[model samples]
Target: MKPLSPDVFDAAQALWLQIRMFAKGMLLPWRLNQLLAIAALFLIAHFAAKPIGHWLTTWLRKRQGWTKWKLRLGILIQQRVRVILFALLAWILVAVMRELTWPSRSQLIALAASIATAWAAIGFVTRIIRTRLLRRLVRWFAWIFATLYFLDFLTVAENLLDSLALSFGEFRLSALTVIKAVVVTVVMIVAARLFSRFVTRKLAKNSDIAPEVQILISKVLQGVLITLAILIGVKAAGFDLTGFTVFTGALGVGLGFGLQKVISNLMSGFIILMDKSIKPGDVISIGDTFGWIEELGARYTSVVTRDGREYLVPNEDLVTGQVVNWSHTNDFVRLDLFFGASYRDDPHEVTKIAINASLSVKRVLAQRTPVCWITGFGERSVEYILRFWISDPTAGITNVKGQVYMAIWDAFKKNGVELPYPQMEVRMLRANRDEENAPHFQMTTSLKD
Candidate 1:
């Protein structure tokens, strides 16, 4: 090779001198200047970056007319930005180390490692920022990012790894293969998130469904997006989906045995959703278990009862059992109060009083119009049936009944319509002498058998 330029030689010599100085400082038993210098640099960067990030974030929020949540969100973003900036500065210091250590392959390798580590750090911070954007947006971001970084770090470390492999007369692998896999995986995840957000936003814009339903649908869409993303990531990881047909048999066997209940419930849940028979917020009664439908999972439905207990009913039960949807077509529910009045009271008058009593209740729906009828004639009383409807079922049936019955009690007392008790008439025979004497009178009329 031609002799290097004078400038290059001088630069090389300077780098060599810095490396020698650094090594000597490390070897010195009591030298503290190098350590203090490094610590001072880190502290300066940390304090300076944090305050600057905070001021910048505050200014941004003021300009954007941020809400309390948004301001808090911005503060979190600023913190993350500060950390990332500090990390980048640290990496730049390592690159400076490589420059001062002369042009050696190991120095270049260390520089590359530092760059890879810094890149992973940036990605981790970005994921955290994204997760914190919405309220409690799931804290799984750190785990996922860590896994991704490990995979990427493994890929980037392949060069030194393959050299070791070559020393053992083994096969060599390129770092590019591993790096490409990580890049493609990251791209897939980002794409999935974007697509999911777009679909969820679109679904939320539809006003027909309840808010909970919209949120549930959005979650389902996100799950589907993630599944698709996984498939794409697998493809990017150098796996050919078409070549993996042999795994189908294994998958089928797993589904047949291990995942039977999961598959069954999932299918049943889909059916329930499509039929629109059971939905979020519906007040459904399944056997003795009655509650508002809080969530519909793949295998079970969560019902939040009035007592604040949540019941998880299997999806199959919801489809197979008798479900009383109190608010099926409408929120109107009718309650019947059966009362029996004294036989001396006129049947027509009893019916009129019952009707008026139902009308007096505030919860009674005027549009439905309360109805009363003389349902039956008993030995001691005439039975009256009062049927009335109310609009809100989630407020409960008992409360409505209480109001109507209270009104009825008041009306009956005012109208002098006494609610009769159960009564019976009985005849008793006297002793044998009296029975024989009574029978003697009838003996002439009829002969005993």
Candidate 2:
């Protein structure tokens, strides 16, 4: 309300001039015309893209030769057809504008078109990447670079990224350097995995190569390739490896203390693979855990029990501890069942019946047959031992044993063979002098009564 100060008046006048200049720039004939053209192009594209995309997609689906390729292409069209059509139209419009020699607007329109095309391309690529985190990272990187390029500041941004660095002695690390290292490492790792799988398949197809040998080769190649990739990435990042000699020495000492069990397990895994002591599908028993080996990993062996439980056993345990490998040489296993019959029953008949019972079970090996013999003469019964062979201990030993026992019960019941129990006969004795004095003491007691 009062008279404004001199400084305030000057500042207000400057602000008013800036507002007028901004309005004037917006009102320029060429700028306004370019904006209108962009609007018009966007509207046309928006309306035309859907119908065109639908028609193209339908046409592609009709011409289906390469079944696998066509299926993949059909998916792409179904999801991104509109974006693809719009991008194409924008590019065509940009080209036409350039041909007309509209220098001021052509570059801007081309940049916009390029951005739309790049976005569509990135979207398609990210869909193929599969991993959510990796796809998001790629999307962010693509959009950032695209924006920088559109703004004509790509070189400046790169320079700034490179300039922001930290130096460690002769080694310098910058944002650009780190980015390059990460990209190179990721690419190398992916390539190594693919190559390893290809080599593994080839090795697996070779009839001469054992499965264990194939596994060993694949694992070794994978380790070497990954290590090589890391080294190459570090070198590309401009890191001087010679400077890390002391660091590595210290790291080794630290690892020795902290990762003794891990290193032992890793070495033990190599020993197991080399010796072929424990392999996949091999039935093994260690301590109380008995199961077939599902997988032999670097640190642990996956063992799945009959109860549908999987245990991750340390590799070192298999190397150092006593492990009973049922299928080490062959799947054949011998099981013994002990029973005794009443002394009154015919031992010969018992033995024959036991043999038939053992043969009755399906899992019992018929070629080897079964044997029954007298093991011991017990106090109450004659102990007989029934021995049978089974080819698949992995299927289970206890269940087969139980089945054979049930068969024995059925055979014994049908044959009228009696299973025996313990019986004791007790007798009491008196001293000789007590026996002699008994008649004299009995006469004296009768007179006293």
Candidate 3:
């Protein structure tokens, strides 16, 4: 074999020396003992986790007086009970071991405990996250960071990421900065949304507050919280606020041009809420869409029609266009209907029957009562107008009208009130004198009601 080059020989010798040093360190009595301790602890944790988790779940189930959300949280804990138990066990054992011996002797156990604790926390949080992809990303990110931290390489990684950066004027952007911004922004925004929902629900339950007022207050609170969240997130991400002044100015200009309708809709939402003209469950008619208000969004209003179709109408349209609010100030609605009877029927008796028929409908308001009057006498029938009041418009207008009409038909049939149909007559005459003298018999024909 040819003689080795000096560079290769030196590299091999250095590698061997490093290997020897590593072997020597591992051979240390304390190091070997700690390795054995860690292996034993792993076995203990693996076997003990199941029974302890079971016991915990059983105990939690047996408890009384827990709120629904509390019970839900308990269920989440129980699902991660294995990791929790392991974390507790490792911490307790490692603490006792550290006290009895040198703390450094139990470094492996301490590392394991830290990792277990982090994993348990991540497990619970990831489970609560609704998105599957997000949950997986968070889990992996947390595990990598925790492992890096325990291995003492987190600072090195951070420094490496920080080095990969771009500079513009006085501003610098890096992988670390981007990651921090995203994480901080997501966390703060999620917290804001959760808090907004909780507070909104509380406001909704307050009986003294009007529904529109509740909606307005909740929306205002949400807007404030989200704004604060964005600002705080940017601050936490280590950006220079002074440098962002130009960026914000440019952003405002972009929004003004690109989002004119969007901004209008948002502002319109606030106006709608403030004016108290419409609220949740109010029957409204906008152009072709007719329904009760289901919810008020920043950009749109949810209207659920009687046909079960939900239309998301833009808030700007609601502000600008005509909206017929049936239940604006009161539940009473006066509906006018036309009916006719034969001229033979007494107008007074027919009026009483029609009024009773309208009142007999379940939705017709008894306190307000129904009124009927003869409008005019047609050529063959008496034309009358029927008017009635309904307190619950949201129940539906068309259906109630049909019901009242049916009730009227039934009452008319029972009371012998005749509903007349059109009658027509045709007479043919011959100009001849002979035809005029020959007719003792004349034919008459008419349509019956």
Candidate 4:
């Protein structure tokens, strides 16, 4: 084997000396007592934690008028009671031992207390992070770092990480830098998203703002905040932002070609939102699809139809194709009903009956006043058209039309108006009864009621 490098040799020698010193220290009576005392304190804390945790949970439950924040804090503290108690007790023992005996005798207890303290504090603080995997990883990372610092091995770790590096003309990147970059990036992005969401929710509650405007504001704010966060995080982690211009340009070019439709839809979505032509809860008809607008997404708009099926219509279609917004200005919709009555019936009496029948329907707008007029005279009867208004179009138009038809039928039946129908008459000429099977026949029609 080649001779060890100078740095490697030095590190090995330092580690050997530390091991020897640790072995020597353990042989002393005071060090052994110190170790035993820490072990006993940890044991006592573990056994006492169960009862303390139970009691704390009960106490919090019994308390009245406590804020949710305070209750949550108490629960978090209760979960780490063992570590917290051990840290406190160990420190007190360490202080007393130092006062009564040599300070060196309590150093082991101090180290234990220091580690326990870091564990309890970091664990409690990390509990508030919502993502489960991220929270666990952060806790582990913090614990390891704190442990290294307490053991005076943090500098060693830094040197190790720094040794594994790539150097450019003026910039150097090491493992430590990369780790810090990841941590900072995650922190900044999460914080930005949370803040953006909170502001969006507050904006949503304002009745003065239109729905599309609210969405536009939310999208613009989220994009800006995330962009700023990324830049700030990269700079804060000691990376030069100027170095990414060429890469960003190349990425932009690639995205433009690869995501043409996606970008178009996104842009179209923004246009739709800005124009305020369509909004949530608006009943829109595109192509053959008709429904209430559920949500506006970057790529598509969610439309839920009367049949309970949801259609994801592309934003491009909404922008390019013809869209009919039924309730755009107001909820009022006018529907037409056509029917004919016998020629013998008076037109004035028929119009009056039709109007009264339309008014009797529940969905027909009584305030708007339904109207009936003689559209034209049919071949055998008088044709009439009834026009009526409805306030709610989303409840459906077909059912309400059927209701009006039924009302009109009932009203006409209750009165003396006769509905016209065609009557068929057949006259067959047979040479004799023998020709009845293959008879020459004449067909005639009559329009009568």
Give lDDT per model, in order.
Answer: 0.67, 0.80, 0.83, 0.88
Query: Where is model 2 more than 4 Å wrong at Cα?
Result: 1-113, 116-143, 146-151, 306-308, 340-344, 373-384, 419-449
Sorting all predicted structures by lDDT, with the top scorer first, yields 4, 3, 2, 1
Angstrom error at residue 242, model 3: 3.8
Evaluate model 1: give its TM-score: 0.61
Better of 1 and 4 by lDDT: 4
In model 4, the runs with Cα more than 4 Å from the true position are 1-68, 71-106, 123-139, 167-171, 194-211, 258-262, 285-324, 335-358, 361-363, 371-387, 393-449
Per-residue alpha-carbon lDDT of model 1 for 1-449, expressed as tens digits?
A: 75534544554555556557656755553334334544555576677886788787768756665576667666665756644554566556657765775444233233334544454455444543264543123234343444435435433233332333211134233334444555566556667778878876887788887755665676577678777777777677665567557687788897789988877887788778777788888998899887899988767999998889999999988887889998878888887888788877787787887788888878788889888887887766777788888888887777778888888889889999888764443454455773555522211222111
Tens-digit lDDT track of model 3 for 282-384: 8999998889999998899999999999999999998999999999999888888888987778899999999999988888988887899989988668989
- Of 3 and 4, the candidate ranking higher by TM-score: 3
Each prediction's TM-score against the native?
0.61, 0.70, 0.73, 0.67
lDDT of residue 298 for candidate 2: 78
Candidate number with the higher lDDT (3 or 4): 4
Q: Is candidate 2 or candidate 4 better by TM-score?
A: 2
Best by lDDT: 4
| Model 2: colliding residue pairs | none
lDDT per residue, candidate 4, 13-116, as tens digits?
A: 66567657767977799889888998899999999999999999999999799999999999899989999999999999988988898888899899999999
Per the 3 Å backbone cut-off, how many clashing residue pairs does candidate 1 have? 0
